[model samples]
Target: MSSPFSNTVYVWQALFLREALDRFFGSRAAWAWLLVEPAMHIGFIGGVWGMMRRNSMGGINIQLWIIVGMLAFFLFRRTAVQTLHALDCNKAFFAFRQVRPFDVALVRASVEAFSMFFISLFILGAAAMMGLDVLPDDSLKVLLALSGLWLFGLGYGLVTSVCMRMVPDSGHIFQILMMPLYLISGTIMPLRYIPLPYRDWLLWNPLAHGLELVRLGFFSNYHTLTVSFSYLYYWALGSIALGLALYRGLETRLVTQ
Candidate 1:
């Protein structure tokens, strides 16, 4: 059902993905450390939160709440960071005419997406084994919300990648900005915990809505009346369009650099 050109693209994509993974993991021991890091992070956060609040937040299991939020946030952050630096990071591969900067970014995004999928499964499975409720009440909704998060990150990455390519130093500024965005996006705290006027302002962030939708899918009783799927989609689509437009305009400079 696929044309030769599409199949050739697939082959290049796979090769790039493998190269990215190799560069990321570096060794078998690094892979083991990667698995341990998330577990420790989740444990520390969950343990601290569990001590402070004995009951579930909004009737969702505390561990599940943290894990879901963390995974969604992590996926976006990881994908964006990877895509943002894809060009400069893999510039050596550009020696091949088939390996465009866009291809590098695409391969980096694909690698992060695939890595997150497996990492999420491991976290959820580990939580389930620990007797936490790791199952989603609405699987389809969760899938959509998570997919939106990834797509949004991919789009945002495209824009940022172009920006970074144009101005290499901007990458550092973007990394610094991501910290506050991560906290405000409700990675460690639920929106319900925030007081009135502040909650209204945080809701303006599209990622906050995506995180809320993720929670909505995971917990039957959990509900966020403020989340707007349309708003999130608008930003996601807008970013992708703008990024593509910018990339096309600067493709010549990007390829030369």
Candidate 2:
């Protein structure tokens, strides 16, 4: 007889492999597309910056800064977005009694994280080879900050998934909401460009904190707003807790709807 804990572990392993196969190998050159997408984004931005004749931003190598911050944002965005549609993505899996909606959500988030890890490594490796200073001054802090962003993304996905399940129209709104985050989260723009007093307000977006912390970790000389991991994690944990509550309360509806 398998204990529930072991059974859950087995389920996760099965789900992970299934998700991995589909994500990394489901389509022709699927893995290649994954690697190419981000590299292309980075290349385009690097080209733009090169044309502008700018060499640095926020006191760090512009190339490294963009590469690190963009990768971090992608990590969080992928995790959250994938998790948001997890239930629908794995609608077929719900046929099994053991496969709860939240179970699929968790598994989907894990899948994004696993894939992004390699994508980051590959991008950073290529950047370093190209003479970009991609080495982190504080690797541990970089890891922690990036982890926070991912956790928050998972939490965001959970809460939003339930919301979308309850009111399908809101899913469209959530999709739209992600667009502004690219700007406000400081992925491509320097918050310093926003002007002093007004710029501070953007920090209200928890992702801003996570992004700054990542840049700070990567370059000791990197100058940016002071950010707290606590702010980001608070949202992460709180959203996850609330999302779980919603799922527990609406388990029947989630599976049905």
Q: Estimate each model's TM-score.
A: 0.92, 0.97
Q: Count the backbone clashes (under 3 Å) in each candidate.
A: 0, 0
Tens digits of per-residue lDDT for model 1 on 80-125?
Answer: 8888987777767667676666777767777777878888999899
Score each candidate by Cα lDDT: 0.82, 0.89
Clashes of 1: 0
Q: lDDT by residue for model 2 over 36-77, one digit each (tens)?
A: 988888888888998998889988888888898899999988
lDDT, residue 146, model 2: 90
Error of 1 at 54 (Å): 3.0
Candidate 2 deviant stretches above 4 angstroms: none
User: How close to the true structure is residue 224 of candidate 1, measured as C-alpha lDDT?
Assistant: 57
Error at 77, model 2, angstroms: 0.6
Clashing pairs for model 1 are none
Taking every candidate in turn, the Cα RMSD to the unseen true structure, in Å, is: 2.2, 1.1
